[model samples]
Target: MSLYRVFDIAGTGMSAQSVRLNTTASNVANADSVSSSVETTYRARHPVFAAELSKAAAHQESAGVRVVGIVESEKPLTPEYAPNHPMADDNGFIYKSNVNVIEEMTNMVSANRSYQTNVRVADMAKQMLNQTLRLGQS
Candidate 1:
């Protein structure tokens, strides 16, 4: 509604993107991990985001983005037949993390761009407020 609200909205946007980036980084970091058992294998994690509404009855205006939760992927892990691998299970098969590097990299780029956009929005709002104050002085 106001220029000040712009800063708040942008800040929330940045924070949400930060969380997304962190989760994406985590998923990427564990992408190469291997485990002998399905229970011990790492799964790709994704952040769940929800829109915060300002009013429930009146005009539906977004307050900001909120991270509701982080969920692990349900996709089955990669089962590789590594007979020589030390971590192989009884069946000579090892389970690799379900994280796809390309997908995670794409998510990282998107989050980075979103974060940068929020920063630019905040900066523009600050400049506008400063110019408005200068106008009143003259």
Candidate 2:
């Protein structure tokens, strides 16, 4: 595979990780949100990733990562009895978001590391290209 292809693959990976980080941030932001009903409650959102196999094959014959979609978590919401709360339902039960703080934090850390790795990969590719050009000049 060409050196430039390395940049392309790494760039795609960085983009996917950016999306994942964004979704994880959103999930964390809404973790404490409460609603009167399940329909109105905030569900933990996650980014779905898929392999860009064809493009990867065209570039280096390897699989590359891609963000497929952002999906809401299916876990049941937490119900709490808050009779005086404004958003409480008829049964005085408020539905809280299903987002787990620890999980979101872990995801954030992972996405951050993945993004950093991609950046390093792209930087290395750039250095290699520069070296190749220098060799041609010599």
Candidate 3:
């Protein structure tokens, strides 16, 4: 693979991580939201990623990561007994969002780390290119 491909790969990685972080943030933000019905409760969302192959390279060579889609978590929503709450159902139960705050926090950290690593990779590639150019001047 060419050094230039590193830039493209790292860029795509950063982009994918950005989407992941956004979804994680959204999930966390709605973690405490309550609704009167299951249909009105917020569901945790997560970004789906897929590896794409580079057309310029061999079939097995990975081009970069792509976000296939965002999917809602299938976990059951938390039903709490809040008899005096405004959003309580007929049974005095309120459905809370399925978002797991701890899990979303973990995902946020992971996505942040991944994005930083990609940035470092791109920076190193730039430095290497600069040094190569300097070599011809000596």
Candidate 4:
């Protein structure tokens, strides 16, 4: 693989991490949200990642990460019997979001670490490129 391919791979990784972080934040923010119906209740979302193998193969390079889609959690919503709640249904049941704060926090940390790693990789590549340019100048 070429030195520049490092940048492409790391850039894609960073982009995917960004999406992960955004979705994690969204999930955390809606963790406590409640609604009258399941459809209106916020569902925990996660980004689906896949390897960009075809692109990498076409370029004669190894696969890089890509976010295929964002998927909502399939976990059942928590039902709270809060008759006084504004969003409570006729049965006095309010549907709380399935988002788990702890899970979201963990996901946030993972995404942050991945992002930092990608940043470091990109920075290293840039430094190496700069060093090579300096050698040519000298």
Candidate 5:
């Protein structure tokens, strides 16, 4: 692998974390939403990622991350009987979104730190390349 491949790997890491952040944000935004039916209720979404590894058979050894897909949680939604609520169904029940705020917040924190770590890695790679060029100058 080339020294420059570090940047590409770090970029993919950052991108995967960005997708995590976006999905977490979306889940948080819909956390308090109420729906008239279970079918229409919002569910938590999570991004799935896969790692791509270059094979030595092809004389490449760079590894990177990719988003496989985003999946909705299979957990059941909460239904409450609220006859007075405006959005209640004919049965006087409202379905609450299955997003857990605490869990989503934790995901946000983790993703933020991962993104920061990837930034530092890319920065370190750039510094190393610069130092090598400086050595040549000297």
Candidate 6:
């Protein structure tokens, strides 16, 4: 594969990480959301990713990352007995979001690192290309 493909691969990786960061932030921001019914309670959402692999072995193309979709966590929502709460249901229960703040924070850090790594890779690839071009000046 050409050095130019490195930039494309790194760009896709950065894009995937960005999507992950956004979803993680959304999950954290809605961590305290409360609802009277389970249907309305906010659940943690996660981004799905897939690798764009090559089918032909002769070319040996570079693979890139792609986001599949964002899906909500299947874990059960937290139900509390807060009869006095204004958002309590008729049966004196309130549903809380299933988002785990600690986990979300970890995910955020990981996504940030991945994004930074992709940036570094792109930078290195650019430098390599530039150096290759500079060889002609010698």
| C-alpha TM-score for every candidate | 0.92, 0.93, 0.92, 0.92, 0.94, 0.94
Instruction: List candidate 4 segments past 4 Å from native.
Output: 59-63
Give the Å error, residue 67, model 1: 0.5
Better of 2 and 3 by lDDT: 3
lDDT of 3 at 25: 92
List the candidate 1 regions with Cα displacement exceeding 4 Å. Answer: 55-62
Candidate 6 collision pairs: none
lDDT of each: 0.93, 0.90, 0.93, 0.91, 0.93, 0.94
Name the lDDT of candidate 4: 0.91
lDDT of 6 by residue, 1-138 (tens): 788888989999999999999999999999999999999999999999998875324467667999999999999999999999999999999999999999999999999999999999999999999999999889
Among these predictions, the greatest lDDT belongs to 6
Query: How much does each candidate deviate from the true structure in C-alpha RMSD?
Result: 2.1, 1.9, 2.1, 1.6, 1.6, 1.8
Collision count for each candidate, in order: 0, 0, 0, 0, 0, 0
Model 5, span 1-138: residue lDDT tens: 576989889999999999999999999999999999999999999999998874433557568899999999999999999999999999999999999999999999999999999999999999999999999998
Q: In model 6, where is the ten-residue run with the lowest total lDDT? A: 53-62
After superposition, the stretches of candidate 6 with alpha carbons farther than 4 Å from their true spots are 55-62
For candidate 4, the C-alpha RMSD (Å) to the true structure equals 1.6
Candidate 6 residue 70 C-alpha distance from true site, Å:
0.6
Candidate 5 off by > 4 Å:
54-61
**Per-residue lDDT for 52-103 in model 1, tens only?**
7745226645478888999999999999999999999999999999999999
